[model samples]
Target: MLPPRLNDGGRTDLDLATLRRATFGLKLGAGVTLISLAIVEKLANPEMARAMLEQEPLLNLLAPFGVSADAFAVVAGSVELLLGLLVISGALPQVVAILTAVPFTATLALFGATEFLGHLPLYGVLLSFLVLGSLEETSHSLSGLRRRAGVPTH
Candidate 1:
């Protein structure tokens, strides 16, 4: 039989199902990487945590809040790992993924920003950007401003 035709009647840039599935894989893989780093940097190293705070005058300014480096690292790192898993694995819906990316994205922006704003280290920020871009790119694959309506095209 002849191959199927490419209908020009408002077709998508790519197949919706294909995009969704691929996005899920991306979300999961990147999430795992991020979680792993968060654990190592935040959970395992108190000195590193202190260094993070000390590195940023803005962050240090907040020290009056009486937050210990270890405590801050534990909470921040654990949350990043947890959210990363959820986003990458699609354990949560697209909505949750979007919400999760907000913090993740900001984290990346902070890292990227520090290079100029604070002119501090670059490695940490670079890693954060990698994870952030992966996670964001995965879910942001959602197409169309509005949902298409047709015969339940699944």
Candidate 2:
């Protein structure tokens, strides 16, 4: 059932343009944070990063894949750097958001509830980008869906 607040007058009161701008800001911030962490923790202080990754069950999880914590750190860091750049550049943001979610989901699965709560904000950001699609578009897939259902996107 549609929420009464959202279903008022067969149109949403939400301002999608503002929502899009907010999502972009969040995506950019997440990208910068990823870049900084990659450089400082993984690329610059590799030994310390490896030590951190070597913690118990996480280390055990990597064993079956034949990936040492050191190698994983380097590779993961490189991926983070690349994804961060892509995100900041606004290149295929939806794809980047999905890719970013993989690691977040894996971490949540590995570490459980605490990590889930910690990452909720990030999850919301990614979800917003995904739902909103390209900021440049006047109407996105979700809007199309709404239109099909005879709902006003605006």
Candidate 3:
């Protein structure tokens, strides 16, 4: 019981539209939650972040470079906060997703399998958003604003 315009080639374009909107809404909610969590974990509990960094075995390599673990924690937390905002913005999903994965990749390498397994689901979710979100659907970001203002996406 579907209209012809929505039932092309035996596929329900209407159903696909519903699915897309549902998934997008889920991603948006997830992005907001992530932003809030990152702020709390990284910014509010910076000592905890530094302690976690101290637990990383690979910090040994950076010690010779005089890298202060506390400072690194602050920088990392700031970057995480920014990336969390980017995720919520939904601009250039592919680029944002890839950037968001970088810290986790470092964490996996530095902290080993436990860390990787803990964050694997996050990576998977980001990948899913990147793969499923179409560029045309990203009209709520700064880039989108620029586009609406007659500026180039670049």
Candidate No. with top lDDT: 2
Cα deviation in Å at residue 21, candidate 2?
4.8
lDDT-best of 1 and 2: 2
Q: Worst lDDT window (10 residues) for model 1?
A: 137-146
Off by over 4 Å in 2: 1-23, 57-66, 134-154
Q: List model 3 lDDT by residue over 75-142, tens digit each.
A: 66677777877776667777888888876787666668998888877888687667655444443332
Lowest summed lDDT window (length 10), candidate 3? 138-147
Superior candidate under TM-score, 1 versus 2: 2
Encode model 2's per-residue lDDT on 108-143: one tens digit a residue.
766789989988877886776676565434234222
Question: What lDDT would each prediction earn against the true structure?
Answer: 0.54, 0.68, 0.65
For residues 32-102, could you state the per-residue lDDT of candidate 1 as single tens digits? 77777787787777678779877853443335798666667777777777876565545434455455555
TM-score of 1: 0.53
Q: TM-score of every model?
A: 0.53, 0.67, 0.65
Please tell me which model should have the higher lDDT, number 1 or number 3. 3
Model 3 gets an lDDT of 0.65
Clash count, candidate 3 = 0
Model 1: residues with Cα > 4 Å off, grouped in runs: 1-17, 60-64, 105-154
